[model samples]
Target: MRFDLFHTRVDAHIRKAQEYLQAANLARIEHQIAADHHLALASMYAQRVTWLEQELSESVSRFSPPFRGVMTVAAEGGKRGAESVVSLQRSAPVSNG
Candidate 1:
């Protein structure tokens, strides 16, 4: 094998650049899929918590007649939020979505 220091250095530089590019590509992909797209799950949980809080507040209302309208609205909003989450999950790619 011929040992050309200049060619060896160039080859090393090229390899390093390729590795850096590969790392950058991987980072971009990872950033795009942060949390494995479990954001929908988090959103679902948050909406559920909100609904529960509203329900609890409505139940403990001092008024003689609890506010059914507020409760109903909260329930529907929670339901919609859950449905949307499910929809999003279903629509996502099968693997690593």
Candidate 2:
């Protein structure tokens, strides 16, 4: 697939995932503020927020580097890290001078 299509799809996916992340945060706040508040409910939603964040990160890592410093490979680790670096290099624009 062309980089344009890939970028577009990835952007769309990230936007959708962001909505879920926001919902998770809202749930955490709501639970925290409720009269029957239980820390566990807020904690559960907080964990969901973390999971969604990682999901978004992994999704971004799959894309062509949109720009410099896309994903710090160290944050990814292992084979996936190597693959993202290769993908970023390959997708890097060729400069003419």
Candidate 3:
């Protein structure tokens, strides 16, 4: 699924969870059974939101490129020289042959 759509669905679930919680709170004063049902629905939505967030995080990390370094430009004698200013170590294990 597309990231935007996934994000929108997550947001919708969050709103549903919030609405259910509000309903549960309101129902708690008059009907305990109704309150319990709403609470259960809220919990289900909350769990789904948690799962979706974790999935989104993992998906982003999986697709993101590893940061290697930053390039900086220096001027000397009217000439531009490009140099890597910051270098980062690779996250993956390096193998020696």
Candidate 3 regions exceeding 4 Å error are 1-30, 65-97
Residue 72, candidate 2: how far off, in angstroms? Answer: 11
How should the candidates be ordered by lDDT, best one leading?
1, 2, 3
lDDT tens per residue, model 2, 36-86: 566768888999989987887787767656422345554445335343543
Q: Which ten residues in a row have the lowest lDDT in candidate 1?
A: 80-89
**Model 3 quality (TM-score):** 0.35
- Give the TM-score comparing model 2 with the true structure, all chains together: 0.31
Q: Kindly report which residue stretches of model 1 are placed more than 4 angstroms away from their true locations once superposed.
A: 1-8, 35-38, 62-97
Question: What tens digits encode model 1's per-residue C-alpha lDDT throughout 1-97?
Answer: 8878555587778999999999999999998798767897899999999998877776757543324444545566755432233211355557764
Better of 1 and 2 by lDDT: 1
TM-score of each: 0.46, 0.31, 0.35
Which one wins on TM-score? 1
C-alpha lDDT of residue 80 in model 3:
41
**After TM-score superposition, what is the CA distance of residue 21 in candidate 1 from its true location, in Å?**
0.9
lDDT of 1 at 43: 94
